[model samples]
Target: MTSAAFDTSIEETVEALTGPWRQPRQMLHGQTYDSHASIHDDATAQKLGFKGGTIEGPTHFSQFAPLCERLWGKAWFETGCISAHYRAAAFEGEEVQAIVEKPADGGNYATIRMMKRDGTEVLRGSASIGIDAPASALDIRLTELKPLSDAVILRDIKLGMTTASQTVRMDFDQNMGELYPFSLEQKLKVITEPSPYYAPESAGSSPWGRAIIPMEMLSVLFQHGSKKDRLPVKGPSVGLFADQEIRLLRGPLFVGEDYRLDRQVVAMSGSKRTESLWVRTEVFDNSNAPVATMLLNLATLKESYASYDQEYAALPRS
Candidate 1:
């Protein structure tokens, strides 16, 4: 395009979001939490060192992307990248605050700071405004970066397969200008307009309530491996939540509740030439109660298919 077109798009971006927008409500309250447990679930708040299960760290950050889309438009997730520090822990049913400190946005570049309700810091994030084409990015169209050939699905996993020896604090569910109360109630009220798995009730919430953690965000809590590393049998990890077979082991994760996450590599199989990895993830609350679990599969696409360099360009100074 010409200089005029560039100027026009720039202007549009500045005036992109009219009225007011919110940081995701999901961040407001965390699920019940507990890191220490016997089998992932069926423990007590005493052993886990808390009253309930804590929210999955990865699940906490995923909320930002949607907020970015709301603030900057759909293009944000295209070239967007995010990373953060887990400041505090959220439990199954407690409400926290999620806030955004505006960025110094430039074409192809933007920065944002987010925090939680307990007066804690969360993430220092930036986006490269579509700088390098990512692996899933297509030259001619928007193609999902496929790192595997078929979706990997596993079953009957042992609990506690996924264990993290780390701790982080988080916040969310800012007062919503005092329009709402209890982030869970407020959040459950609203659903992604085009959600794939569930929907909102006329009350604008899901009776299902909140569980251990949303399965889609689980991929981040593990060692996803380097974008450059390729496994002959496993291949590199580039997959989406094709489907989930989630089970509620115990109760739901509520605010003030600590949580422990466990993962079981249920199974892995596909032609060596065909890349695929499947696993089952399980989560339990501090009481050692099975909060929720799921079976998710990721399909891999040949690495030779796309650009790896640009995809890592915006990955937050690793």
Candidate 2:
């Protein structure tokens, strides 16, 4: 028997769907660090005051998939965008649920939030369709982003500089080395939303005619495919994803397809405690066709790294 990809139950007044509570799977981070020792590593995280390696922020977006489909149907897959601000970290084995609120007038966007079973808010964001989505969580955050007043680690990254493109693909059975670096089967085992479509044999049942990559994994795809060594920012400074936005152009990106990734530094903004760089990455298929785009706000903690006052003082004044 073929199981449906998602729950199609639609409410009469405003559509609503509650996802199954899921625990954080550490597979993505494991792939991200190549099993290296880092903050994402369990022991490192414990030393930093976290219970364990925190799950990547994008993982929570999967809970909104079924909800977005119910509200906008297939269009959600074609042009849908989910912009979010991760408020708190969720440790491994902790269950969380996503709740989506649709406007009474049946608009193109909806308010969404993910919370732990105990009602602790994990993330808050919006899901919308089309190019003109209402100010999403990341959108609002971008507007509020201010230029750094002092010289910082990210001060050297210039806006509008495009990075070298790289080829990226996701295979259901193969462990994508460096790029994702994990097999699809591994991800499916602990994915927040388990669907038949995520499996190789049942992937044909999907609307995309094959296994469609989950929205969350797109972050991994972009990161590993982009040019990380060329960024001018000096590290050893702890950084975190402050906000993120993902949008597909043609439709759901399928698994096992090669896509070219090009990233551009769009903006640099910061706050009193942190400095950030906003990068927009565009994904193109083998045919040079545009597939999707992702915007990431990577924030560096100023307190974690040593102060640069001496370095700034030595530099010639602007």
TM-score of each: 0.33, 0.87
Q: Which candidate leads the pack in TM-score? A: 2
- Put down candidate 2 lDDT per residue, 1-318, tens digits, no spaces: 345667534333346556667776766455333224444567766755668777778888887888787778778878889988878888878898887887557788788888998888998888898877677777777777777666578767788988888888877777756535587668788777766667788877767667878888777777765535388876556566878899888768878888898888888887776788889999999889897989998877665455555555665666
Candidate that scores best on lDDT: 2
Q: How many residue pairs clash in each candidate?
A: 69, 0
Candidate 1 ranges beyond 4 A from true positions? 1-48, 105-114, 122-129, 132-318
Q: What's the residue-level lDDT of 233 in candidate 2?
A: 75
13 Cα displacement, candidate 2 (Å):
7.9
Please list the C-alpha lDDT of all candidates, in the order they appear.
Answer: 0.33, 0.75
The all-Cα superposition gives candidate 2 an RMSD in Å to the true structure of: 3.0
